[model samples]
Target: MEAVYIDKHYGLVAECKQGSKKACYELYRLYSKAMLNVAYRIVGNIEEAEDVLQESFVDAFAKLKDFRQETTFGLWLKQIVVNRAINLLRKRRLDLTELEDGHLENIVDKEEDDQEEIQYQVAQVKQAIQLLPEGYRIVLSLYLLEGYDHEEIGQILKINENTSRTQFLRAKRKLMEILRQKGNVA
Candidate 1:
């Protein structure tokens, strides 16, 4: 058996490739809000997220000819947005390679214990995520929200795969702590 895929935006992308300004605008309108949210989740700043969104769109359109349509346009654009957001973080000296010693096992133990009964509202979780440290927030957002695996995140952030795993673990532990402190966990 063979697998087939379809993209609803195929016609729009084809028109974009043909330099139809209207198609380009329509594509942008279709994708911008969701892409902006993806960026904001990684960058954790609305303004920077907007900048990443715009840059990703500009880059995507400029390189549209290179896109082979093996995947949906949204997925391709998301890769670009993720890359640009990571680059922006790097410019601000983001480092995911730094190792914190001696406390990870303890965090894991406590996290497991505390997480078993925790319940949180959507808004609370979102607020708590915004309060996380940059490294943790990025790792958590990429892993949990954006559905990137630790190996993929390691490649994206230029860190070891184990490092990405550690970051994710720590991020989860810290997020739980924040939720507890804020009394958002039930």
Candidate 2:
């Protein structure tokens, strides 16, 4: 049974690498829901998330040769979806920075015990993020939700690392304020 599972997994990957459109469709069917979740988290709109998913998959297939199998195929696809979503946010011109220093030394640590609370907090944060200017929203989504560090964010956004860090701080502060206003936080 396990062997059959493994064969289907590896076979799909190999066929995908071989540029089979059928394999691509199979891959999409397997991962599209998860990818859409990630896209919705970042893009904050169902329609936009769908667009990002479509565009990311197209790019992923075109650049499939560059995909090394080191990471699971899902993770690789996630990176592409996140990058495309960020680009879409940027094109909309959202100004994402709400803090000056880009330092969040005092933000509460996220522990396992905080998981439920954090999820609730994230809902509020997402609402706040949607309210941000386009640039700030993009920076915040890439840095916070997508888990790209400052250097990588800078590269993706064509800005310097310091700018990414600053934008992150601003985004955090704005999110906090929004949550507080919504009575989700103190």
Candidate 3:
């Protein structure tokens, strides 16, 4: 069944590449809801999510030629939506900070390996992340929830990799502070 879905997905991409409007519409119908949820997660508003969804499809269609199929079409389209949402957030003058290379290395090294502890931390952290400033919140969402690497985040935000890491660290710190204030931790 999953194989059938994969075949259909690839066929749609091929047809859309061939400029089939029906295929494009089918792709839109298939992915729009999931894409909208992704946009909403980043932008945190229904209206903005709708707008981003439309804009992302437009951008994806426009640049369909560049898509190499190294990953699934859904993943490619999701990246476009995330990039557009981040760009929109930046244009609004959100205060996102960049991290240095050393800092990013430190963070990667410091990440916990224990699954149980990590899950507990992640749950607590997510609650605090919700309280972050808009810039930090969006960055955190893109990096953590959406599984984008710092380099991808940097490209989306027009910053360097270091900046993405720094913002992530700042977001984490701010989240921890918020959690502490709420008495979720010591």
Candidate 4:
């Protein structure tokens, strides 16, 4: 199944490299919605996400000739999208700080029983994530929603790997607190 997907995009990408508009549109049709969702998750706004989606595709298409399938086309495209989303945030004066070994862990409970929790609706979970401070929200979105490991997230966000881990743990606990406030904790 993975091979089939790779094969399909490979052909479209080849055509796109050769300046095929139809092929580019076909590729965009296949991935645009997912791209929009990724952008929205990062930016947390509809208009900015859509703008990022357009810019990402434009940039990706321009650089199509350099794409060697070391990774899947989708993964390559997602990297571009994520970088662009971060850039957009930067344009809005989002300042990413390095934790000075701030001992954030002291506030995070480690007890096993504290992990027990009730199920949250998808909307509620999303709402809670949106309510997070930008740093925590972006780290959580990249690590959990986008499946980036701490090292990868650190590279992407230009922070220490340990900082990414700390941010993720803090985001998890903060999310739980939000859910608890909403009476969703068991």
Per-residue lDDT of model 3, residues 1-186, tens digit only: 133234448888888899999999999999998898788667765667789999999999999888776778998899889888877786775433321222111112335577556565655555466567876787788888788899988877788899889999998898878888877779
- What TM-score does structure 2 among the candidates reach? 0.69
**Candidate 4 residue lDDT tens string, 67-129:** 888788999999999999998998895432322222111322346554333122555677778
Model 2 off-target regions past 4 Å?
A: 1-10, 19-22, 66-72, 92-122
lDDT of the candidates, in the order given: 0.82, 0.74, 0.76, 0.82
Off by over 4 Å in 4: 1-7, 94-120
Q: Distance (Å) between predicted and true CA of 162, model 4?
A: 0.4
Candidate 3 stretches greater than 4 Å from native? 1-8, 94-128
In model 1, where is the ten-residue run with the lowest total lDDT?
Answer: 99-108
Clashing pairs in 1: none
Tens-digit lDDT track of model 2 for 83-128: 8887787687444334312221223455767775766565556566
Show model 1 residue runs off by greater than 4 Å.
Answer: 1-5, 93-120
Kindly list the per-residue Cα lDDT of model 1 for residues 57-168, writing each as its tens digit. 9999999998887789999899999999989998985533322232111212325655543322554577677777888889999999899999999998989999999999
lDDT: which is higher, 3 or 4? Answer: 4
Best candidate, TM-score: 4
Indicate the TM-score of model 4.
0.81
Using TM-score as the yardstick, the better of models 2 and 4 is: 4
How close is each model in CA RMSD to the real structure?
Answer: 9.4, 8.9, 10.2, 9.9
Q: Which 10-residue window in model 2 sums to the lowest lDDT?
A: 97-106
